[model samples]
Target chain A: MVPVEYYVGLSAILFTIGTLGVLTRRNAIIIFMSIELMLNSANLLFVAFARTFEALSGQIFVFFVMTVAAAEVAVGLALIVAVFRTKDTINIDEVSSLRG
Target chain B: MAPVNLNDLLTILPAVFIVVWACVLLLVDAFAGALGKRLTPWLTALGLVVALVLDVSAAGVQASAFNGMLEVDGFSHAINVLVLGAGLLSFFVSYDYLNRQGIAKGEYYILMLFSISGMMLMGAAADLIVVFLAVELLSIPLYILAAFAQPEPKSEEAGLKYFLLGAFAGGFLLYGVALVYGATASTRLSEIVAAVAAGLENPIFLLLGAALILIGLGFKVAAVPFHMWTPDVYEGAPSSVTAFMAVGAKVGGFAALLRVFIVAFPSLGVDLAPVLTGVVAATLIVGNVAAIAQRNIKRLLAYSSISHAGFILMAIVPYADDAVHRDTAAAALFYLLAFALTSFGAWAVVMTLERAEGKGLELSDYAGLFRKYPALALAMLVFMLSFAGVPPTLGFAGKFFLFRAVLEGGYVGLAVLGVLTSLVSAYYYLRVVVIMFMEEGKPQAAGSPLLNLTTGLTALGTVGLFFFSQPLLDWATNALLRLF
Candidate 1:
C-alpha cells in the first residue's frame, strides 16, 4: 500500500547517510559498517522496485548483493585484525605508513 | 527455466575450469602442506594455460548463454587471453618473490586464479548482475592478497584502504544497477539496448545510472579523481601483487566499460560522450603530472598506469561512432595487451631488485643498476620506452591505433592531448632509463631465473609484437565485429 516514491526517497536518504559515514569515519570498522549500510540501502531500493514492477530479477539481485556484502565483511574484518596486530590501532589516520 | 545445453556450459568453460581448479588447489594446499606451497604456482600457471587454450578454442562459438546472462564471443576471448596471460606472468614472477619474502603460500596462487576467473567472467557477462558479481569476485581476492604479507603493516593498510574504497565503489555500482533496472525493467545488456532503442521510460534515471556506473568502474581502473587508492595500494602491496592488479584490474574494468557503454547504452551516446571526454582528459593530466613528483618507483609506476588508463580511455571515447567503434575497441584491446606486457616486465625487474624491508624502492636505489645487471637495465629501458610509446615496441603501435581511432571519431583535441601528455610522460619514463644507465651506484638484484624469464619474454613481446601487430589488430577487429 505504500507509495513507491516514499520508498525511493527513504533509500536515497539512507544511502546519503551511509556515504557520509564512510567519508567522515576515522575508525576502519565504522567505515566497513557504513559500506554495509550503503549496500543495504541499495538492497532496499532493489526490493521496492522489484515489488513495484513485479520482477523477480531485482529481488534476486539483492540476494547476491547480500551474499557479497557478507563475504566482504569476512575479508574486511580479517584485514582489520591484521592491521590491528601490526599497527596497534584501527584509526585510519594513525595507520599512515605509506604516502606519496 | 530453459533446459541447459552443452553449448551453454562450453561457453563459460574457461572460467569454470579456473574456479574449480582454484577450489581444489585451496584444499590441496591445506592438506598437502609444504609441498602444496611449492607446487601451487606451477599448478596455477598450468590452470591458466589450460584456460587460455579453452578460451582460444571456443573463439568461434559466439552466442549468449545462461538465458542471456553471458555472451561468449571474440571480445570476451581477446580479453580472456590478456587476463590469463597476465595471470601466467604474475605466477612466474611471484614464485621467487614470494619465497624470498618468506610469504610463500598456496592461497596466493589460489586467490590469483580466483581473481583471474572473475576477470574472465567480466569479459563474458551480458547482464548487470553478472557484471557486479564478477567485479566483486575479482576484487575480494585482491583485497585479501594485498594484505597477504600479514606482518607488514603497510601491506595491511593497503588492503584496508583498497577494501574501503572498493566497497564504496561497489555501493555506487549497485545503486546504478537498481536505477537502470527500474528505468528499463531489465538488467540484460541486450534487453536494455532494446528498451533504450524503443525509448527509455525515464531518461534521467538511465543517465544517472550510467554515470554512477562510470564512477564505479573509474575507481576500479584508477581514473583521475577516483584514483586515490592506486598509488598507496600499489606502493604498499607486494610488487608482484601490484603488477597483477595493475593489468588485471584495468583490463577487467575496461572490459565492462566497453560492453556496458557500447552495447547497452549506445543510444545514450550523445549525452554520455562529453562526460567520457572530460574523464579522459582529466585522467591524462592528473595521472601523468602527478607521476612526475613521485620519488618511489612503485608509486611512479602506479601513476604511470593511471595515465595509461587515460590513453586506453581515448579508444573508448569513440564508442558511439559506428564508423570507428570497432577500430577503437580493437585499439583499446591492443593497448591493454601492450600495457600489460610492459607493466609485467617492469614490475618483474622491480621485484628482483627490491630488498627486504622495502629498502631498494627509492629512485636512488635504481642508480647504477646498469653496472650490476646490464640485462635488467636493458629490459627496464625497453619497458620505459614502451610506456613512453616509443618506436620498435607494442606501445607505439597501440598508441598509433588508438590515436587513429580518436581522430576518426572527430576528437582531434583528445588525440592531440594524448600526444602532448605522452611527450610529458617521456620525461619521467626516460628518467628511469637515465637513472638505470647514467647514474652510478651499486644495486644488487636477485638472480631468479623465472623472474628473469618473465622480464625477457615481456620485453621481447614488447618489441616483437610491434612488427607482428597486424595479426593482433585483426584479432581485435574480429572480436568487435560480433559485438556490433
Candidate 2:
C-alpha cells in the first residue's frame, strides 16, 4: 500500500502552492482558483488520514467539503461577474477604490 | 449511527425553523412580486420572532442531540437570542435605508435569516463537520449581501474580496479539522477532548491544527494581521448590511471560537495561551491605531469593532486555566452583549445620517448633527461613550469584567495593555461625538422613525443595562458549555 506520509507530503505541497498563489495573484479568477486548490489539498489530507486511521468520519467530512466548495464556486463566480460588470476589470489592484 | 429521534429534532428546533421558514419565504417572494417584496421583511421579522421565542422556551432545557452533533445549552440559547435579535433589528434599521436606496427586495431578508440560522447552529455545534457547515452557511449569504448594492463597483469589490478571503480561510479551517481528526481519530469535539486527555496519536498535528483554526476564526472576527479585508468590506457594503454583519457575524465567530478551543481543545490551552495573548495584543494595537487614520465612518467603526474583538479575546486567552474559564466565558458573553447594543445604536445613527447614494459617510459629514437633532446627538453620545468604555455605560462594565477575569488568570501584562489600548481607543470613538456636537456642518438625516426607535432603544439598553443588568449578568455567568 502507498504510505500515508506520501499523501500528507503531496497535500502539504499543494496547500503551500495554493497559499502562495492567493497571496501573489492579482486576477480575481486566479485567486479564486487558488482558493479551490487549497480546499482540494485539505480534501486530499482528509482522505489520506481517513485511510491511515481506518475511520469513515474523515471520508464523510470530505463529502461535505466538496459540497461546500461547489456552493462557493457558484457564489464566488457570481461575485466576480458582479465586480466585472461594475469595474470592467477583474484585477484585484484595479478594484481598489475603498482603500485608506 | 443512531437513528434520528424527536428529541434530536427539538434540540435544533430554532435553526431548523429558520431554514424551513426561509425556504417558505423564498416561495412566498417568488410567486408574489411587489406584494412579496413588501411582505418579505415583515414575514422575516415574524419568522425570526418565532425562532427567538422558541429559543427562549428551550432556555432551561439541555441535551446532546443528533447523537452528539448538536448541543442545547445556555450558551447556544444566549447566542440564538443575540443573533436573532440582531437580525430583527437589522430589519428595522434597514427598512427605510433599503427602500431609500431602491434596493428593497425579498432576497435581503431571506439571506439574513439563513445567516442567523447558521450562527445559531454555530453556538450549538458539538462536531467539527457541523461547525464547518455553519460557517459556510453564515458567510455565503453575507458575501452576497455585501454586494447587494451592485453594479455599484465598491459593493461588488467588497463582495469579491470578502469571498476570496473567506474562502481562503475556510481552506485553512478545513485543513485544521483534517489534521486534528488525523491526530485523534475523531471529529466530535467532546470525543476529541477525551482523546486528548487519554493521549493523542500525535500532539504536533493537534497544535498545528489549532493554530490554523485560530487563523480562520481571526479573519472572521477581523482581528489584526487577518483583518486586511475588513475595512474595505465594511466601507463598501450597504450600511444596513454592514451593521447587521458587524453584530451577527462576530457573535457567531466568537461563539465557535469559545466552544471549539475551550470546550474541545482545553488540553492544549497551556500551550496556546501565549499565542492567543499575542493575537489579543496586536489586534488591540493595530485595530485602534489604524482607526485614527480613517476618514470614512464605516471603516473607523470596522477598526473599532476589531479592537472590541481584542478585549473579548483577553477573556478568551485566559481560558486555559480551569479556575478562570467560567469567569472569562461570562466576561466574554457580557462584552458581546455590550458590543451588540452599542454597535447597533451607533450604526443606527450612522444609517440615519447617511444621504442618498452613500454620500454622507465621511467623518466630516457628522459635523453639526447636534444642531438639528439634539435627542439623536445625545443618543449617539451614549453610544460613543459606551464604545469608549466610559463609566455609567455597558462598555465599561464589559471591559471591567473582561480585565478582571484576565488578571485573575495571571495575564497581568495583557490586562494592563488592554487598559492602555482602551485609552487609545477612546480618542477615535470620541472623535465622532466631537464632530456631532462641537463642529459645524449641515448634516442631512433620513430621520426614519424606525431608525429613531432602534437608536433610542439600543441607547437606553446600553446605559440602563449597565446599571440594571444584574439578572442578565447572572444569566451570562450561567451560560457555560458544560455538555460533556
Candidate 3:
C-alpha cells in the first residue's frame, strides 16, 4: 500500500496549481474550472485521510463537499452567463465597469 | 449510529423555520406571478417576524442537536436576534429600492430569506461540515443575489467577481476542515476539543488549518488583504442588496469563526494571536487610509465597512485567551448591532437619493442636502457620526466595549491601532456630513414613507441605544456559549 504522505503531497501540489490557475487565468470559465480543481484536491485529501484513519466521517464530508461544490458551480455558471449577457464577454479583463 | 431524534429538530426550530419559510416563498412566487412581486416582501417580513417570535420564545433554553452538529445557546440566540433583525430591516429598505430599480421580482425576497437561513445556521453550527455547508449556503444565495440585476454590466461583474473570490475562499475553508478532521479524526467541535486536549497527533496541520479557515472567513467579513472585491462588488450590486450584504454576510462569518476557533483550537492560542494581530492591524490601516481617497459614496462605505470589520476583529484577536472569548463575543455582537442600525439608516438615505441609472452615487451628489431635506440629511449625519464611533451614538458604546475587550485580551498595540484608525475614519465620515449640510448644490431626495420610516427608526436606535447600552451588553454577556 502507498504511503499517505504521497497523497498529501499530491493534493497539496494540485491545490497550488489550481490556485495559480485562478490567479493567472483571465477567462471566467477557466477560473471556474480552477476552483473545481482546488475543491477536488481537498476531496482527495479527505478520502486519503479517511482511509488512513479507517473512519467514514472524512469520506462523509467529501460527499458534502462534492454536493456543495456542484451547487456552487450551478450558481457560478449562471453568474458567468449574466456577465456575458451584459458585456458580451466572459474575460475578467472585460468585466471591469465598476473598478476603482 | 446517527443521532436521529425529535430533540434535534426542536433545538434548531428557528433556523428550520427560516428555511421552510423560504421554500414556501419560492412556491408562492411560482404561482402568484405579478401579485407575488407586491406580496412577497410583506410575507418575507412576516416570516422573519415569526422566526423572531420562535427565537424569542425558545429563549432560556439550550440544547445540542444532530449529535453535536448544532449548538443552541445564549450566543446563538443573540446572533439570531441580530441576523433576523437585519433581515427585517433590509426587507423594509429593499422593497422600495427594488421597485424603483424595476427589478422587483418575488425571487428577491425568497433569496434573502434563504440567505438569512444560512446565516442563522452559521451562528449555531457546531461541526466542521456544517460550517462548510453554512458558509456555502449563505454565500451561494448572495452570489446569485449580487447578480440579481442581470444584464446590468456592473451588477453581473460584481456577481462574477464575488463568485470567483468566494469560491476560491471556500476551497481553502474546505481544505482547512479536512486537515482539522484528519488531525482530530472528527468534525464535531466537542470531539475536536477533546482531541486537542489529549494532544494533537499533528499540530502543524491544525495550525495551517486554522490559518486557512481564517483566510476563508476573513474574505467574507471584508478584512484587508482579502478585501480586493469589496469596493467593486458594493459599487455594482443594487444599493438595497449592498445594505443587506454589508451587515448580514459578515456577522455569520464572524459568528462561525468565533465558534470554531474558540471551541476547537483555543489550545493553539499562542500561534493564533500573533496572526490575528497582523490581520487586525492591516485591516485597520488599509481600510481607513484607503477610504480617504474614494470618490464614489458606495466605495467609501465599502471601505468604512472594511474598517469596522477590523474593529470587530479586535474582539477575536485574543480568542485563545481564557474567559476573554466570551467578553469578546459579546463586544462583537454589540458592535454588529450598532453597525447594522447605523448602516441600515445610511443606506436608506443613499437609496432615497439614488436615481435610476446610478445617477446619485458620487460624493458630490450629497451637496446641499440639509437645505433641501433636513430630516434625511440629519439622519445621514447621525449615521456618519455613529460609524466614526463618535459620542451620543450606539457606535460609541460599541467601540468602547470592543476596545475594552481587546485591552482585556492583552492586545495593547492593536487597541492603539484601532483607536488611530477610528480617528482617520472620522475624516471621511465627517466629510460626507459636511457636504450634506455645509456645502451648496440642488439636491433632491426621493421621499418614500417606508424608507423615511426606516431611516428615522434606525437613527433613533443608533442614538437612543447608546444610553441603554449597558443592558444590551449585559444581555450579550449573559449569552454564554455552550462550549469550553
Candidate 4:
C-alpha cells in the first residue's frame, strides 16, 4: 500500500500546481479549474485523515464538500459563459476598464 | 443524539424558509418564462417579505440548532432584517434600472434571495464549516451578479476580480480552519473556546489560524490593504448591484466578522486586539485619504466604504471586559444599520440620474443638479450630509456612538483620529453637495424617473432615522448585552 506520506506529498504537489494556475493563468476558466484542483487536494487530505483516524465524520464532510464544490463549479462556469457571451472574449487582461 | 425540538427547528426556520422560497422562485421563473412572461422576481420579493416577517416575529428567542451548527439570537435576527431590507430595496431599484437597461431577468432576484438567505444563516452559524459554507453561498451569487450586466466590459472585469480575490481569500480561510481544527480538534466555536480555556501552552497555531481567518474576512469587508479591488468592482458593476453589494455584502461581512472574532476566538483577544487596532488605523487612513482624490462618484463611495470598515473595525477591538465589549458591539451594529440606509439611498440617487445609454453620472456631472430636480436634490442632500456626519442625521448619530464606544474603551487616540478623518471625509462628501448647489458646469439636464414607492420609502427611512436613533440604540445595546 502507498504510505500516508505519499498521499500527503501528492496533495502538496497538486496544491502548488493549483496555486501557480491561480497566480499566472489569464483565462478565467483555467483559474476556476485551479480552484477546483485546490479543493480536490483538500478533499484528498480529508480522506486521508479519515482513514488514518478511523472516523466517519471526516469522510462524510468530504462528501458534503464535494457536493458543494460541484455546485460551485456549475455556478462558476455559468458565470464565465455569461461573461464571455457579453465580451466575446475570455481574456482577463482585455477587461480592465474598471480600474481606479 | 436527541431529536430536534420545536425550538431547534424554529432557530433555523428563517433560513430554511428563505431557501425554499428561493428554489420555488427559481423553478417558477424557469417554467413561467417558458409559458409566458415570468412574475417570479415579484414573487421572490413577496416570499422574502414573509420570511422577514417570520424572522422578526421570532426575535429574542435564543437557541442553538442542528447540533450547534447554528445559533440564533436577537443579533442575528437584526442583521437578517437589515440584509433582507437591503434585498427588498435592491429589487425595487433594479426593477427600473434593469428594465431600462433591458436585462431584467427574474433569475437575478432569485440569486439575490439565495444570497440573502446565506447571509442570514451566516450571521447565526456557530461552526467553522458552516460559517465557510454560509460565506460561499452568499459570495457565489454575488460574483455572478457582479458580472450580470451583459455586454459591459467593466461588469465582466468586476465579477472576475471579485471572484479571483474572493476565492483566494476563501482558500486562506479554509486553510486557517484546517490548522485551527488540527490544533483544537474541533470546529465548533464552543468546543474551540473550551479547548483554549483548557489552556494550550503555546498557541502559535491558533494565532496563525486566526490571522489567516482575519485576512480572509478583511478582504470580504474591503478593509484597507485587502481593499484594492473595492473601487474598481464598485465602479464597474451595475449601480443597483453596487448598492446591493455596498450595503448587503458589508452587513453580511460584519456579521461574520463579529461572530468569528468576538465569539469563536474570544480567548485570543488579548493578543489579537492590538493587531486589529493597527488594522483599523490603516483602514481609516487609507480609505479616507484615497477617497479625497477620486473623480468617479462610485469609486469615491467605494473608498468611503473602506473607511466605514475602519469604524466598524474599531468596534471589534476586544474590550478590557464584557461591558465594554457589549457597548462597542452595539455601536458597531447600529452604525452598520445607519450606514446601510444612507449608502443605499446615495446609490439610489446615482441610479436615478443614470441616462438612457447609461453613460452619465460623474462627479462633474452633478454640477447644478439642484436647479433641475429639487426633490431629488433634497434627497441627495440628506444622503451627503449624513455621510459627512452632519448633525441630526443618522450618520452623525452613528459617529457619535462609535466615538463614545472608543472613548469608553480607552482608545482615546483612535477616537481622535476617527474625528480627524471625519473632518477630512467632509471635504469629499461636501464636494457632492457643493456640486449640486453651487457649481455651474451644467450636466446635460434630464428628468429623474420620479422616485418609486420603494425608493421614496428608503429615502424617507434614512431621513427619519434621527428620530428613531434612541430606540434603535437601545435594542442594539440589549442584543449585544446577550452576546457576551
Candidate 5:
C-alpha cells in the first residue's frame, strides 16, 4: 500500500547517482557498472509503476531490460578484457589512442 | 490473449529468416574451421538478398501483426530495403578487406547479419518495447565488431568508447520509455497516441520523455553534442565496420524517430519542433565546421556522415506540419537511400586504400590516385560530388526534395542554413577530389575485384538514381501514405 510518488522519487535519486557515476568514473569497469545501475533504476521505476497500475506490460518490459543488460555486460566485459590486453590498463583516460 | 496467426508470422518473415540464418552460420563457422570463414561473407550476402526479396514481395500487404506490436507496411519495407542494401554492399567490401587484414572470422558475418535483422525490426516495431529491443540487438553486435580486430589497441579503444557512450544512451532511452509508460499506462504507440489525444496525463512527463528519447536517438544517428564517439569510433574501427555503422545505425535511428514522433507525439508539435530545429542547426554547424580541420580521411568522412544526419533531420523537422507531412517523410527516406549509396562508395574506396595498423588514412595518401587507378579515383569523385549535393547525382535529388519540404513547411531559416552549410561541405568534399586528380604523388592502389565492384556499382547508382528518381520518389511518397 505504499504511495507511487515515493517510489518514483527514490528511482529519480538512484538514476541521478548512476548518471554521476558514469560521468565521473575513470575506470571502464566502473563506468560499465554505473550503466547497469542506471538500467536497474529504470527497472525499479517500471516495477513500481506497473504495480500501481496493475499492468503486466511494465513487468514484461522489465524482463526485456534485464535480458538486454545481461547481453550488454557480456559484450562490454569482453571489450574491457580486450582493451586491457592491448593497453594493459582499464583506465579510460589512458586508453586514448584514438582522438581527434 | 489475441489469437496467433500465420499472417503475424509472415509479417516478421524477413527478420526471422535473417536471424535463423545468422545462427546457423555462427554454428557452421565454429565447427567448419577455415572453410567457414571463407564462405561466411558470401552466405551472409545470400541471406540478405533472400530477405530483401521476401521483403519486397510482402511490401504491398499492409497490416499490423503480433497484437499490433509490429507493422508490415510500405514504410517499413522501404527502410528494410535500404538497410539490407547497405548490408549487401558492406559484405562485398568486407570480403577482401578481412582477407587482407587477416581477421576473416565467421563471427563477423554472423554479427553483421544479426545487426541487419535488428535494423529491419526497428523499421517494423510498433511498440516501444520492440523498439528498445531492436536498438539493443543492433547495437550489441556493433560494439563487438568495433573491436573485432582485437590485437590493435585503437580498435579496442573504439569498441570501449562506443560501448560506454552507447550504453549510456540506452539508459536514457529506457528511462524515457518507462516515463512514457508511466504517464500513458501503455507502451503501444497507438494506445499512447490515443491517451495523449484524450489528455489523460501530465504534459510535463510526456515532454521530458520525448526529449530523453530524442537524445538517445540523436546519439545513435550521430547528431551534434552526442556525436563525440563517432569520429573516434569510425576512425579506429575497421573501415568496413565503420561503413556499416554509418549507414545501418542512421537508418534504424531515423526510422524509429519518425515512427515514434509522428505517431505517438504528434500532439506535442509546438513543444518538440523548436527543440528539433535547434538540434538540426547545431548538427549542421558542428558537423561541417569540424570536418574542415580533419586530415584523416576516415575522420573527415565521419564528420561528413554527421552532417548528412543533420540534413535528414531537417527533413523530419516539419513532420508535424499537416500540409508537408507526406513530403517530409518521403524526402527523409529518399535522403537515407542516397546517403547510404554514396557513403558505401566512399568507404569502399577508403577500405581499398587503407593499410595495416590504420596507416594510409591521410588526405595526402590519396595524392595521384587517379593515375594509379582511374576507375577507383573516378568513383571516389562521384561519391565526393554526391556528398556535396552536386547536380546529376542522387544526393542532389534527395536534397532538392528535402529543402522544398522544409520551405513548404515555412522553415525558411532552416532551409537557408541547410543550403549554406552544404556549400561549406563542398570545400572538404572537393579537397579529396582535388587531391585525387590534380595532385601529383604515387598513391598505392591495392587491387581487389570485390571492392572495385562495390565502388563501381554504388557510383553508378549515385548518378543513375538521379535520372530515374521518379519511381523512387513515388515509392517514398506511397510508403509514407500507408502510415496515415
Candidate 6:
C-alpha cells in the first residue's frame, strides 16, 4: 500500500551508498560490492517504474539486467580471486600497475 | 499475430543466422569431444564468412523486422559487414595466437560470435531498450574474453576492471532510458521522435536522458573523462583481444552512438551542441597529449583510440545541431573502416612480436626491428603512418573526409583542432617508427622470424586498401545515401 515515492527513496538511498562506497573503499572486493549495489538500485527502480506504469517491458528489462549482473559478478569475483592470488592484495590502491 | 513470409524471414536472417551459428558452436563445444575444442574456430570463421555474405546480400533492402525492434538500413548493413569481417579476422589471428598461448578452445570463438551478435543488434537497434540490451550483450562477453587467460594475473585484472566500468556505464544508460521513457511514454526511437515532433517540450528530462546516454556511450567509445580504463585494460588483456577490441567494439559503439543521437536526440541539438563541443575538444587534447608519455605500445594505442573517439564525436556535432547530414555520417563510417583496418594491422603486429611466454613488448624493444624483421617492420611502419594520418594512406583519406564533413557542417574550428591534434599525435606514432628504423637492436633480440600468416595477410590487406581506398569511399558514400 506504500506509494511509488517510497520505492524511489529506497533505490536512491541504495544508489547513494553505492556511490559513497565506490569513492571511499580501497578494497577491490568492496568496490565490486558497491557496483552490485548500484546495479541493484537500478533494478529496484526498474521494478518500481514497471509497477507504476503497468508495463511488462520494464520488468523484462530488469530480468535481463539481473542476468547480466550475475554473469558480471561471477566473472568479476573470479578475476579478483586470480589477481589477489598473484599479487597477494585485494586493495584497489595496490592494483596500480594498470593505472596511468 | 500474422504468420511470417520470406520478406519477414529475410529481414531477420542475418541476426538469426549468427545466433544459430553461435548456438551451434556452443552445443558442439558442450557435447562434441576434442574436435569441438580444436576445430570449432575454423568452423566459426566459416560461419561468419557465410553470415557476412548474407548480410551484404540483404543490404539496401530497408525493412523493419522483429516487430520493429530491429532495422536493416544501408548504414546498419555496412556496419554489419565491417563487424563480421573483423570477427572473422579475429578468429583467423586468434587461432594461431591461442594455439601458441595454449588457450585455444571452442568457447573463445563462441563468445566472440555472441558478442558480435550483440554488436549487430546494437547497430540495427531503433529502440532504447534494444540499445541497452545490445550494449550488455556486446560487453559481457568481452569482459570474459579479456580475462580468458585465467592463469594470467594481468588478464584477470583487465577483466575485472572492464567489468566494473562497463557495468557502471550500463547503469547510466539504463537510467537514461527510464527517464526518456518516463518523459515520452515510450522506449521506441520512432515513438520518441514522433512525440517530440508532436510538440513535447520537456527539455529537462530530454536533456538529462540524452546526457546520461552520451556518457554511457562515451565510456564505451573511450572518450576523455570516461576513458580512464582504456590504457590499463588494453595493456593487461591479451594482444589479440585488444586488437579485436580496438576495431570491432569501436565500430559497434560508434554505430550505435550515431543511430541514437541522429534518430532520437536530434531535436535536442540546441542544448546538446555546446556540451558535445566541450567533450570533443577535451577528448582530442587529452588523448593526444597523454599518449606521448606512454612507454608501453599497447597503452599508446589505447590513448590513440581515445583520440579517435574525439574525431568520431566530431561527426555527431553537425547532426546534433542540424539535420542528419548524410555526408558527415558517411565520412564517419569511412573513418571507422579506415581506423579499424589500420589499428587492427598495428595491433596484429604487436601480437606477432609478443612471444608465447606472454612477455610484453615495450617500445624500446623495437630497436633495430627493421634489420631483424624487415617485412614486419615495413608493415608496422605502414600501419603507424596511416594511424598518424600521413598522406595517401587510408587514415589520411579517412581524416580528410571526416574533417571535410565537419567543415561542410560548419564546424571549422573543431575541424582545425582535429587536424592540430593529429599533428601532435604524429610524434608518438612516429616514435615507434624511429625506434624500429633509426635505433639499433639490442643484442638479446632473437632472430625469430615474425611472418605470422593470418596477421601478415591482414596487414597486407590493410596496406593494399590504402591504395584502393577510393572504391571503399564510394561504397561508403553510397551506403550513407540511405540515411539522407
My TM-score estimates for the predictions, one after another, are 0.98, 0.99, 0.98, 0.93, 0.99, 0.93
TM-score of chain A of 2: 0.97
Q: State the lDDT at B363 in candidate 4.
A: 89
DockQ of candidate model 4: 0.44
| Native contacts kept, each candidate | 0.77, 0.86, 0.83, 0.30, 0.84, 0.51
Q: On a 0 to 100 scale, what is the lDDT of residue B71 in model 1?
A: 91
How well does candidate 5 score on lDDT at residue A33?
A: 90
When only chain A is evaluated, what TM-score does every model earn?
0.97, 0.97, 0.96, 0.93, 0.97, 0.92
**Candidates ranked by DockQ:** 5, 2, 3, 1, 6, 4
RMSD each, Å: 1.1, 1.1, 1.1, 2.7, 1.0, 2.6
What lDDT tens digits, residue by residue, belong to model 6 across residues A1-100? 6787798679778877987887799888888888788778877877787787788777887887788788878777877887788888978668666766
| DockQ of candidate 3 (2 decimals) | 0.84
lDDT of 1 by residue, B1-484 (tens): 7978887887799999999999999888888888876777888888999998888887777888899899988889888999999999999999999999988888999999999999999999899989999999999999999988878888888999999999999999988888898788889999998888888668888888888899998999999889999999999898899999999999999999999889998877888888899999999999999999999999999999999999998888878788888889899999999999999999999999999998899989999999889999999999999999999999999999999888987889999999999999999999999999999998989869999999999999999989989898888888888888
Kindly provide the TM-score of model 5 when superposed on the true structure, using C-alpha atoms.
0.99
Weakest 10 consecutive residues of candidate 5 chain B by summed lDDT: B200-209
Candidate 2 wrong stretches, greater than 4 Å: B481-484
**DockQ for all models, in order?**
0.84, 0.87, 0.84, 0.44, 0.88, 0.54
How many backbone collisions does model 1 have? 0
lDDT, model 2? 0.89
Off by over 4 Å in 6: A1-13, A47-54, B1-10, B321-324, B356-360, B442-451, B454-456
Give the clashing residue pairs of candidate 4, or none.
none
Chain B TM-score, model 1, reads 0.98
Question: What local lDDT does model 2 show for residue B145?
Answer: 97
Residue B330 in model 6: lDDT: 81
Off by over 4 Å in 5: B3-6
Off by over 4 Å in 4: A1-21, A40-55, A84-91, B3-8, B33-38, B319-321, B441-455
Which CAPRI quality tier does the interface of model 5 achieve?
Answer: high
Strongest candidate by DockQ: 5
Give the distance in Å from residue B434's predicted Cα in candidate 6 to where it truly belongs.
Answer: 1.2
Q: lDDT tens digits, residues B1-484, model 4?
A: 7777787766778888888888887778777665423577678778888988998898888888988888888888888888888888888778877877777888889889888988998788888778778878888888888888856777777887888778767766665665565456567888888888888644776887788788878888999788988998898888888999888888888888887777779877889888888999999999999999998888999999999999888888865346577888889989998899888888888887777655666888888888876777778888888887887789989999999988987888899989999999999999898988898865653333433555566668777878899899998987765566
